[model samples]
Target: MSDAVLLLAHGTPNTLGEMAEYLDKVTGGRAVPAEVVEELQHRYALIGLRETAGAEPPPLTKWTLAQGQLLGRLFFDNGLKTKVYVAMRNWHPYIADVVAQMRQDGVTRFRAICLAPQNSRTSVGLYRKATLAAAEGMEVEFVAGWAEHPLLIEAFAEKLRTVWKVACDELGKRVPVLFTAHSVPTRTVTGDAPDPYPIEAKRTAALVAECMKAAGLGEQDWRFAFQSQGVSGGPWIGPTVEETLGVLREEGHRGVVIQPVGFLCDHVEILYDIDIAFRQIADEMGLKLWRAESLNDSPLLTRALAELALGPYTAGVEVAPISARV
Candidate 1:
């Protein structure tokens, strides 16, 4: 049987003109306020301006495809006859388009892995539903979460260690490290059968913290927050990064380091949200902020994804449920 690995990601608009369309897809064709679109347009423009200034913001759509190609090469090198396919949930080369291409390629079955490490019905569930709807004739295995995958944890921890010392030295103290993830609506994970997202997300942070201990961070030196919360409505999950930063400042901290444990690659969320918006808040509060780099096209990330694809993955993880994961 011909097999493929379909890598799904939350895609970004390639240009400002596509912002409204992207928002429409994200909100399931609901009307997004014009102000919201304008705000997002501004954010996208900032990223573009950063690219023009030569810092080269992470072009998310490109990064998603690059990550898949790396995974495809890794599979080839490991002697697995699995081709990798890139599908964006919100943009071009969408789930349906990619499934049609796979059909044309004569692939008989495929495994779908959402690029999201921590799962929530809010995001990952939607991706699963869409993929299943598209790939009607193919056998699909969905990896809902891989939060505690050792290599994945290692990738995040490695990122923290790279900047841990500088963040401390720059401020003349061991600043608190804020581990963060994208926030979802409160009801999505708290009502009914609670989604395991918050639990798994914490474990991912704890595991990464444990890895940082080898580099001299303390047990209490780190905490968690949710960032990039939607402005769409209702109470989203919290303590938000802003609130957490406020608490850190009140505790007499002069600085903080932010490591977004949930995201694998740089997108607007990391680029615009953490790097731009969060930094503005931190600066206003006189709390120096350091952001850990995203693991874009990291070989370790590919290894983690590969293990998830070719499982029976049952060990070397700290807090992930082995067999019960969705």
Candidate 2:
């Protein structure tokens, strides 16, 4: 049986024109003129890290490709005869296109893994639905969530430790650790039931904090914060990372280290939201902000994924269920 691994992600537009076009499509033909698209494209252009210069931003798509290639290498290194495929929920190289390509390539059996570690109706759940819709006739198994994977926790802890060491050496003081993840809608948290997100965020933060404490950092020095709240105000996660910074500044925090615990890579959210937006906010608030490097193409993250993929095959162990909290 020819086996393939299908990786799915939420994609981004590759150019301003494409972005504007997508926005118009999503908005049902609300006119987005070419000039508007061009101006917006410049924002991505200024980043200078797009897959193609003067093209629409392919940040998410590029990350998804990198992740798939990394996983493919891991499988190859371990002597697993598997090919990797990447599909996006939005933008070019759409899930449907990738599914068709996979079918044409003679991939008969498959495993689908959504890049998001945590499970929520909006993120992982949506990916699952989309992937299933795309598969239609393909025989495929799915890995729902790996939020509680041991190696994943270890990788995050390792990242925190690395940042803590730098902070100690540079600032001559232990920087307060702020574990952050992307904020989902408040409705997820309060509407008729508790969202699994806050629980998962707290769990991840706790694991990292536990690892830090094991490395001699104290729990009192760390906190869990949420970031990237959309304009909708039903009740996104809190205290917002930016707001936490403000409160910390008021409470006399000198230097702070931020860990984007939610994201696995340095996408626009990490680049713009935390680096550009929050960094500016910290600066204006007279607070020193240092963010840990993202888990982008990190060896530890790769190893974690490898371990997760090979667990059932090599260790004869079933992957643990997603933790209810964290």
Candidate 3:
């Protein structure tokens, strides 16, 4: 194929032993403190451990590849011949390696879509930089963000509806919803490099809530907050999931549903951050918490991605591969 569609994501290590190198790459070769590395090793171990010692395997890479394969099939079903590829930003199958493979395969021009739905300097910006910098002789285009796409909103709304029912049945009453997204350094967004990340995150949350409300759901109350605040510090986004849970507890909310609108699939963030860390905190606060499932291998999400890959991208001029069969 001379043209292809690429899916980019924040990759995870296939096993626990690679945490040091993964952290090194993520920090641009900085020497991550031993304590930090050890802490991360412990966190990764909690996700899943092999029968042997000192090994933890994650399913993010597997799920991401499945997403790509499904998207390729969806394109073929619609009479398109575009190929789909997945590249990791911080681990094996790195962007440069995949670009080299594509070049070797005689693929000329390709459109890249970050697996992240919302755009931010800390996330998609770095991804765009790495991808474009890797493709020296190839035509490259990107779907920077699709936070408010109807299909995407519908996909998330479906998760909410499914989880909301479980929350209601357990709590014996309707509960409030707390929409969330990954927190970035406040400086990057509100400081010098201001971005629409926060706005887009809120827009996604609002759209999902509106979709649910139109379906006669989430009428009790809904609030937006940030999750998985990093150790990079310098004041990340406001009203963290922990803080919000406290507020809900104080407000006498017996239960609350969490919907992470930013992420599209399961990774360390979803696997450990929400499923373990947030859940533990919620239990301590006498609050029941259920996160919306990751959109891994979801047919709706695959269709949404196919739409982006095949849709016309307006960038002062039409982006090539609009036909998706170049």
Candidate 4:
């Protein structure tokens, strides 16, 4: 059987009009008001103006495609003949469509691994649903639970080390670290059969913190917070990074290293939520906020994905259980 790899992620709209459509799909047809749409557009405008290596901003799809290609190349280098695909959860080339295309391409055996390292039922679980639903009669194995992988921990720690140094140099003192992940509803993870998402995310942060200490970076001045909470929420997780920032300001901290452990690439969350919205708050509070760059097509990130793909993955588990053999 020919092997295929599907790099699954939550997608963003390519245009402002598409944003409303994207919101509709993700929110399960809930009505997103005009004010919310305007706010999202503002965030997108900020993201659009922020230049990357050129005078124009790069699309999230471009980065995600690059990541998928790089991951396929890594697997090939590691002696696996593979065809890689990029499947977005809420945009064009949706997971279902991608799977259909793969079937047409005669790929009967494949692995679908979410781009999110920390597996929450709402996030990774949704990816699993989309993959399995479209994978009709094919041998599909979903990979999960690589949040504590050594390579991933090392990758995050490297970025944290670099950004932490910047924060220290700017503030002239070792400041506190705040790790963040995209927040979902609190109950989705707190009910009877509680999800391992929060615990796994915290574990990744803890591993990075331990690695930082071992490298003589600084003491364990770190706390994990949730960020990029969606609108129309009765209550997402907390203490949010914003709330934490306020607390840090009140606590007399002058600088903070924002390490986003939950995200693998630079998207709306990292671009607008952290770079723009959070930065504005930090400026008002006289706090120095520096976020480590996301693992966007990083060699280390490719290594992590390649390892997860090659690792022993268990199938037939209802929760898309994955074991890290690293």
Candidate 5:
């Protein structure tokens, strides 16, 4: 495809009944237990029940589709005639199926990027596999792992500063900042090479903290944590956001700001994990809580992501050839 961009993100179930199938794919065909299934169903129910201004809960798939449209507009405005498509790993528009459709459209070569900024064998690595598997004869290039892009950092930093100001104005005190990302299994990220997921998450957090300092706040006011750990009976990464919350409370910080820099859009992890679950804990702890909004196809994020799609390799970057035919 001379002009195409594929945007990928973690897929969510369209309905509660689809949870088992989604989890099955996510867990590599493992049979989820009844209790685990029930818990997932509960979360999906809560996700579907969410509302804003009396409207219905927003579906992640719909939001992702809208993001693709926005990205297409950005690419067009930037003088690149790229057709953008959104595909999910476990949802309706599966990566492989989407690639098949793209081939029918006469597209030959294209660049792709996952919604996850940080590359990990567990996350972006999976996306790369699916993308390559689907491309029958197309030359596929992926712009993966854009964790430290200045514009991307600026986007989150701006949200952080905005939310921090809101909290301080309402509460009459500066709230500590806690940066969070989805916690992966320790086994997947540990070992000699070590996964860079946490490191990338912290890098974004540190940059946001630096921006906050420029806007007037001490370094000690900010820290990082992980969230949305799986319910699987395995050791996952820590210190989790829940643990960090207790620590902040013990340290006498009565209010806090959450910046989930790892996630680029508002999905179950953000809508429920932070907005509902974490808020419940904060209520019990008597702490005012604020979460920075996800970037979500905003102009800043679009510009940053668009630049990745149109790449010059950033010097010393070597992209491996995908599963393609000559």
Candidate 6:
């Protein structure tokens, strides 16, 4: 059977120049001098990815492509004939256009998967609507979230273990673990709106904690934190990871390990917020800070995603395995 997988993402703007402009707008016309932008530029540059200046770049397009290729190889290795396609929202080569391209390419069976591992109405909901709108009359299955996928938990746990070992060696002491994710508006929790953001975030943290515990790390040594509050409002989930670090410093903890459970790749949040911003804060506060590597194109993550795609699909929802993968 000829099938196709549409991996949907929220892309970033293209090019250093374009990014500078976007950030300026996002930051409310603040003068984000070229130097600051250059620092931001270095983050993407480290991964050998660049955005175009004038063009609005799909932030996740490159990531989607990488993931698609991984899935393609996995399918081929498993003796399955499946073509993978990447569709983006809020950027070029949008979901609608990708659907048209897929239709033109003679794609039949279609499976739509949100690149986000967790499910929240704001995040996956928009993608679901876009996918369905693009599908029109086409038959498509959507996989919303896989918060508790055993393989995913295992991959993250392993990543944490590796980083923790390094932190121990570098700091010569047991480091505190701070698990973080982007924070959503407090309204998302208090409003009548159905936002699964908090639930999913806590779930991922809990599972990771369980895996870490099994690896001999005690729960008391780790804490769940939130970050990247791009908005100012009533409240957002916290002890903000940054704030948590400050607390740790006040408590005289000199070594800390950060694990970003909310994101799979190193994007602006990880690059700037954690790597640069938090590092500076930690340094000034007389503490050592390190982050576990993101699950960027990891074979383990890819395998977990493949398994999720093959399972039954849902809309604007999260589904996770009860146990961690070995």
- Pairs with backbone N, CA or C atoms under 3 Å apart (clashes), candidate 2: 14-55, 14-56, 14-57, 15-55, 15-56, 186-235, 199-326, 200-326, 203-326
State the weakest 10-residue window (summed lDDT) of model 6.
317-326
Model 2 CA deviation exceeding 4 Å by range: 23-46, 49-59, 233-235, 311-326
TM-scores of the candidates are 0.92, 0.85, 0.92, 0.90, 0.91, 0.84
Across 27-56, the per-residue lDDT of candidate 2 in tens digits comes to 346666676666556655555544344443
Q: Tell me the whole-model lDDT of each prediction, alpha carbons only.
A: 0.84, 0.73, 0.83, 0.80, 0.80, 0.75
- Model 3: how far is 37 from its true place, Å? 1.0
Worst 10 residues of 3 by lDDT: 314-323
Candidate 1's residue-wise lDDT over 1-326, tens digit each? 23888999988776677788989999999999999999888898887733232344237876888888888887777566878999989988899999999999998788788888888898899999999999897887777778888889999988888788899888787878999999988888876699989988999999999988878899989999998889877889989998999999999999999999988888788899999999999999998889999999887887777777666443344433322332
lDDT value for model 6 = 0.75
lDDT of 3 at 276: 93
lDDT of 5 by residue, 1-326 (tens): 34688889888776666777888888878888989977767776676732222243246776788788987886666566779988998777899988888898878998888888887889998999989989967998877688877777789988888888998888787788899888899997778889888888788788777767887768888888989988775989999988999999999888999989899888888888999999999989988789988887677787776666666435124322211211
Off by over 4 Å in 1: 49-58, 313-326
Stronger candidate by lDDT (2 vs 6): 6
Regarding lDDT, does 3 or 6 come out ahead?
3
Off by over 4 Å in 3: 49-57, 218-220, 314-326
List pairs with backbone clashes in candidate 3: none
Error of 4 at 201 (Å): 1.0
lDDT accuracy of residue 262 in candidate 3:
89
